[model samples]
Target: MAHDHGHDHASSTRTRLAIAFAIIAVVLVVEVFGAWLSGSLALLADAGHMASDAIGLLVALVASVWATRPATDRHTFGFRRLEVLAALFNGVLLTVVAVVVAIEAVRRLTEADPHAPDGIPMLVVAGIGLLANVAAYLVLRGGDRRSMNMRGATLEVLGDLFGSIAAVVAGVVLLTTGFAAADAIASLVIAALIVPRAALLLRDVVRVLTESAPRETDVTLIREHLLETPEVVAVHDVHVWAITSGAPVFSAHVECEEAVFAEGRAGSMLERLGECLRGHFDVEHSTFQLEPAGHSEREEPAHR
Candidate 1:
């Protein structure tokens, strides 16, 4: 039953991602043509961002679809982690695009008699691109925003939307004042906007890849909660981490009174401990290895 629910969620996310990708892909084609016709750096930069966003959305869709596969003996967790990898890739790609755009903008700004871009065409294309991005954003807004895959796709669309706005503003300035550097300036602004968000996304992806605990989880508090269990005497080797965006996993070694094993109460104690974790920490998947007091000395535990 739980498995079916998860599958449905992934399917819904994939559908939303597909819709967004199609919109971005169409807008990308139009923007590329407009950039070529107008020779506007702002339009070109926005197009490049849109291209990256289209790729990001495609990756997210593939990852969401992959996540629906059942786990196999050889791959116990199945393909859920693929979504994290896709998010990391998307962040890195966006960062690279931003850097390239910034460098090109600088070069254009320094050039002598930089050609005046066709502001009218830029305005028309940017307006169209903005509308398209807004549509994509609306499509994804209702989906799972907590998932890194969905978040990555959303981030891309948001960046593209901002890029479109910058392009339109630059177009207006270019048309009114004939200031050729306005296009370059807008490109730089778009690049600047992308860098911080990309960096934050990359940081989150790295944290997950490293198996660090989720930011919202506190290991000490969880250990304390386990110790509060009547049958539990001590808790050690507690570890908690996110498998993906919304899926957190927990494992720990819990020492209980020796009577728990002798009286056949270990099973009940384990269930109670699981309940405690679920109720207090919102952890749905947990593994607790119940051990008798002083058992750690016999086998040499990994951590105290």
Candidate 2:
């Protein structure tokens, strides 16, 4: 039943990504034309962001599909980790787009005969792009937010959302007040919105790649929980890490009572420990090696 629900959820997420990808593609076309017609750097930046988003969505779509491939002898964990790689790419790509836009905005601001954005076209096109971005954002927002791939995609749309707003504001300001710097400033605003979020996502991607435990997981608490079992005298080499977003893997070496080892009761004790891990920590996959007391003396100290 759990496996079926997970499959259904992935299917639904993929469908949502498809819908968002379509919206972004259409928005990119409209925004590109709009940017050209109005000479607004803000609109151009938004268009560039949308282009990156289109590619990101494609990567995410492929990752999501690849993640479902059955495990093979060569790759025991299957391709599920590809989703994290997709998210990593998205984060880096978004950061590059923002930096590029910021540099261009600064150059435009310094130009002696900088083109003043045409407010009528900027307003009309930005309005259209804004609506399209809203639709895309809403579509992606419905996906599994816990998944890094989905979070990256959703963040891209959110950047687009804020970019659209900046452009809209720039348009209104330029149209009503003839503020020549509004377009460049709006472009900078769009860049600003993307960098921080991209940095945060990159941090998460790195955490998973490095096999660090999930940020919210407490190794100490996990140790305490294991020690709660009377037969389990001590636990060491406790390691926990997330494969992607919600999928965490755990392993530990447990020091057990001499009787538990000698009396052939380790099997039942192992079940109890596994249940504790799953029930209390939400860890579905775990491996434990039972050892007699003081057995770890022969082993080197673990990284923990």
Candidate 3:
């Protein structure tokens, strides 16, 4: 029963990630071609946004696969952290793309005779991108929001949606007022939107790599909860982090009322505690040290 449930969950996640990547890649290709045909900076900006979305979705998909790879003697934790690294890399690349786009847009506004032939193509491409983004967002919406990897994919879709809207508005302005400069202005606005989101994602990915606490969990609160149990005396060396994106893992040393000989009861209680973590807090991996009152301090603790 438990085995089938776990397999089904993993399969569902994999299928969703794959679909999102497919949508992003297809829409991005269309936007790129549309931008070339229209010569509209706003359409190009949407293309750039979609290009980054494709990369983000690819990273998320690859991470999902890597996360399931079996652990080996050479790599104890498997490849789960690759997801965090991929997210960080995606953020950096997106930030760079945004900066380059902004600078180019500004330069074109000053030097080039920036003129768009017609607003129709821009409007059409933007509309398609908007629809694709919304559909992708719907697919990823049910996953764990605290998963930085998943959050990266979600933000990419959202960025594409915003970029599409900006393109549509620029098209409208060009059609009505002959203000081709609106296209350039829209590009800059899209770049500005990308900057903050990329920076925030980069910060979160960095925190995870540095083994900082997971953003959604509080170590102190977890310790307090453990201490509330009758047999627990104190909790120390408590560490908490995510295994992949949605699966949090924790390790800690808990002082107990009895000696080390009381392993049976302690083990059962810890098992129950693990179940509670999975049910309530979405923690998938847990390792706890059963220590006598002062036994933890007497010797070096084991690392699981």
Candidate 4:
């Protein structure tokens, strides 16, 4: 029942992403035409943001499909990591887009010619775009943050929501004051707002793909917990990393005291230790080996 429920949830998420992608695509087309007609950079900037959102949604859809492929002998973990990779790519793409926006704003501000169009029409269009973005954001609100694929999409939605609001504000200000430069200035603000969030997502996804320890996991703390187990004497060569977003895998070497070895229950002791680790840390996958104090020097580091 639990497995079936999980499958159903995954299916629902895919359906939502598909719908959002369609909506964003339609909005992008409308905004592009609107910006062209009104000559409003703010509207154009929002359109560009919608384009990125479309790309992010597409990447998420592909990742979800790939994640369902059955595991094979050559790749035991199947294709789950592909989703994280896609998210990293999306983050990088967003960062680049932000940089371009910043550069364009600098040029316009220096030139002192914003080329602002009549503000009333731009304001109306921007307001509509903002409404669309808010709807899209709500659609993705139920996604699990632990899934980097879902998290990345959520971040993109948030960026679009903020971008739309900025464009609407700029349009309104320009319409009231004819401050043509307000549009360019809003573009710069939107760009700056997007950079840090995108960069943070990129950094986290890269760390997971590289097999670096998850930020929330402490190797020392994990080792200490193992050492405190009744029969364990020495613990070493511990490693921990994220299997995907929320799932974590841990492996380690432990030495049992001579007294415990005398009981001839090293295997059972190791089993209890595994349970303890899981119970304490919410770790789902573990590989632990037991050894007599000096039995067979510890092996080489485990490959990620």
Candidate 5:
């Protein structure tokens, strides 16, 4: 629960995401029109992919807004988890997009279609798309990349940007040399580039959804740091996890010598422990139970 996100940062992210969504939507409409005018199935397919990116951006925008809601009784963590889910959804979408592009590239390589789209129009439309994708990518690039939602949205925009580049390359080759295979080759290359990044994003998303500790935290190291404090006899039941990206939570039970408790030094120990977590581990939300040594031995077993 060490959520360091301030209202200003959240507000900024939401504004940029909204701008990206708007840019992508405008590009999608333009692509659809270009697809109709040229009757190029390739342009139409690209438009479909752009539409998917728009959806992904929209999802990220909505999730960001929801994550800002105040905590409730039923959901004390609020809706921050939605950002992780949106990121997972966007990751899956990116994988599907890469697979689809690969399959289409193979299709074009294996079979020749007689549509014979006008390369001039294709080039013009792709140029516009390339510019639009660039704008959207830059807007999202300003947001928090560590945030799963923002990262996912940024990846989608980046994928669209790659598509626009591939299209531009294909259009140039087709118009200049009438080499149709250029389109398929460009698509294959783009797909190859997208897969690795998509895999990395999905892996990060899975880490959060599975309740894994933040990558930066070292539980063993944290325990040793706690032990270094004076009068701390032992520590146990240590737990660490994240509510979302950049927000780590920690908890443990600290056993002190009986004299330390008798002297009523629990408050000072707790303050020192809290500072340790904040200063060393970058954890702001933590819970600790102060107990005398050997206290845990008298506790009942779980569910017994």
Candidate 6:
């Protein structure tokens, strides 16, 4: 079985994430200062979100770099799963930030006669934040979104984009109507936007960590395809899972005709089975054990 080593893909993605992190880092500083100067909770909430984005980008960048390291005997997968772990951490961080923002927003909303937030500075700073997020989004947009690591970073940028938009709206409302609650309302909206995506990312990470089959692969269909091959009597003990995004591995035991084994055609049958898995199922890594019928009953099978 051939392994598709995505070295170039990982390298390019790392570069993009690094650049995006730099852009977001600058924006985070600006927003924090702006939040302080304007006393706008919306801007503060956006700043907090941006801080999480910066951390998420850093984790993604590290994972990308770690994923490229050569495999060792102790760690055969060679840090590939680091990406998934990073994504999990990012999701948790985002949820925590959202919770904190929501708590503060609720407090502001209920407090009587809150002072009007400074709108002019909030508007100016939030506009700059929006522009920065737009640039970050564009930079990270070109990578494979199927990768959990990239998706985590992309989600951060996406959330920041929405946060900036909400801050701008809050600034506008507070400026025109002297409504201080608008800032708190915008913070609440930003928190709401963060929950769904963070939950999705967390769910995906958990699936991978639990060694669940990828959502796209169907085990029943794979079993049928193997049974269709010539001289194959039965198929059993099939297993499929992903090593990482876009890389699936499979293994199964195939019972074959006695003649096929006696004639020394087992190797040919094995090759054909591998080809079938690769061509039909996009499974590039597979191992098939060819055995005569009843052989499984004779020997203790690892999986019945």
Q: Quick one: best lDDT, which candidate?
A: 2
Deviation in angstroms for 40 in model 3? 1.0
Q: Count the backbone clashes (under 3 Å) in each candidate.
A: 0, 0, 0, 0, 0, 0
Q: For model 3, what is the alpha-carbon lDDT of residue 111?
A: 65
| Candidate 1 residue runs with Cα over 4 Å from true position | 298-302
Cα lDDT of all candidates, in order? Answer: 0.91, 0.92, 0.80, 0.83, 0.83, 0.90
Ranking by TM-score: 2, 1, 6, 4, 5, 3
Q: For residue 218, what is the lDDT in candidate 3?
A: 74
- Candidate 1 lDDT, tens digit per residue, 1-304? 9978977887888889999999999999999999999999888899999999999999889888887787899879888899999999899899999999999999999999898899999999999999999999999988997899999889889888998999999999999999999999999999998998899889889889999999888899999888888978888887888889878899998999989999999989989998998899999999999999977777754585
The TM-scores, one per candidate, come to: 0.97, 0.97, 0.85, 0.93, 0.90, 0.94
Error of 3 at 302 (Å): 15
TM-score of 6: 0.94
Selected candidate, larger TM-score, 1 vs 5: 1
Score candidate 4 by TM-score against the native: 0.93
Question: After best superposition, candidate 2 residue 203: deviation in angstroms?
Answer: 0.4
User: What ranges in model 6 sit over 4 Å off?
Assistant: 1-5, 297-304
Error of 2 at 16 (Å): 0.2
Clashing pairs in 5: none
| CA lDDT for candidate 1 | 0.91
lDDT of 4 at 87: 88
Give the Cα error of residue 155 in candidate 4, in Å: 1.0
> What is the per-residue lDDT of model 2 for residues 188-224, given as tens digits with 9 covering 90 to 100?
9999999998999999999999999999899999999
